[model samples]
Target: MNCVLCLIENDPIAIFGLKKMLEKTNYVKQLEVYEDGEQALHKLKPHLIENTPRTPDVIFLDLNMPIMDGWEFIEAYTAIDRPQNAKKILLYVVTSSVMQRDRDRACELSAVTGYIVKPVTKDDLKHVFEEDLQELWKNQ
Candidate 1:
């Protein structure tokens, strides 16, 4: 099975660019994009009641989004039981904010596997392929 990915980012340029990048990769079979964290959470909530293939193996989350922010999603998601597919989901905080507080807060969230600065590069994505993240992409 190929790996599935999701991006919850409000920036159009960033979403388009990241989608294009993932399309060029060999492993990523699907890419789901959400304009805001709330939309992503709403879609993900259903997985708790029923099985779904839409759950992403890895998530690229933006801290600042309309409706619900990344932190809010993290809180809500963790407050309830997580779906099986989402159990190992690696949610990365991909944001432009370099503030120490934001980074610190993101790291504090159990759902957040890593915190990435804006303009995520090919090297960064490649690095994700290494280390403990190998388990997430390997399942597919």
Candidate 2:
């Protein structure tokens, strides 16, 4: 249940809503919100370097942002020397983008666990927890 949830979106309302939903959830212990991928990446580096528990367990990345979009973030993240804890980290493309190309690209990444549409609800989080997180933990 000890986990970090990262959200990178320019919209404050969306971030707030997601944070509220996460607060209602049982699984997530800690949640981290970022207005842009650049900031998230900057803070994430220290956690990766220290191999700390503050590192995110799941990253809810957005395709659009002011600086460093989800694709760019993933590229940069992949280039770094991910810590042992980071190896278990799951990246999910949580965006409003309904484009097939985006979905296809997201699915192509081995680190990405799933691609989810925007306006993520508690039910969506529940499904992700049950279907993906549970399976991942079981396998590990």
Candidate 3:
């Protein structure tokens, strides 16, 4: 199933590369890119609260940004009182950081689905979908 996706990142090259890769896979029906965490949180909060279909199915978040870093976003986002009927949003920490501490910290969050290193590869993308597919099939 195609999904609506959000990418919160500061680097133009990273955005372009991810956009291109997503396009090639045809897995994303919509992609919203935010330059920083504050923008994403601000823009997505309303949709999430309203339980709109426009709400992203997946979010790729970067740890480092100019304003409102990923950690801050997570704290604020988790605090939001989303409707129970709202779609399940899968959040993934996608960053250049290879630090074990970073990975451990990200994984500690219940909202976060997985963590991927920067320059996301086809294999990583495939794995994301594969996990979703497995869940979908199981439900069916």
Please tell me which predicted candidate would have the highest lDDT against the true structure.
Answer: 3
lDDT value, residue 113 of candidate 3: 89
lDDT of candidates 1 onward, in order: 0.79, 0.81, 0.88
Total backbone collisions, model 3:
0
Clashes of 1: 1
- The clash count of every prediction, one per candidate, is 1, 0, 0
> Clash pairs of candidate 3?
none
After the best TM-score superposition of candidate 3, give how far the Cα of residue 67 lies from its true spot, in angstroms: 1.4
Q: What is the alpha-carbon lDDT of model 3 when measured against the actual structure?
A: 0.88
- Rank list by lDDT: 3, 2, 1
RMSD over all Cα atoms, model 3: 1.6
Q: How do the residues 12-115 of candidate 3 rate in per-residue lDDT, one tens digit apiece?
A: 99999998898788777888899999999999989989866678888899999978999999999999998777778888999999999999999999999899
Quote the positional error of residue 50 for candidate 2 in Å.
Answer: 3.7
Which residue pairs clash within candidate 2? none
What tens-digit string does per-residue lDDT give for candidate 1 at 19-96?
777667765777888888789888877754455677677788898998999888788877767555444677789999
Native-vs-model 2 lDDT? 0.81
Worst lDDT 10-window in candidate 2: 81-90
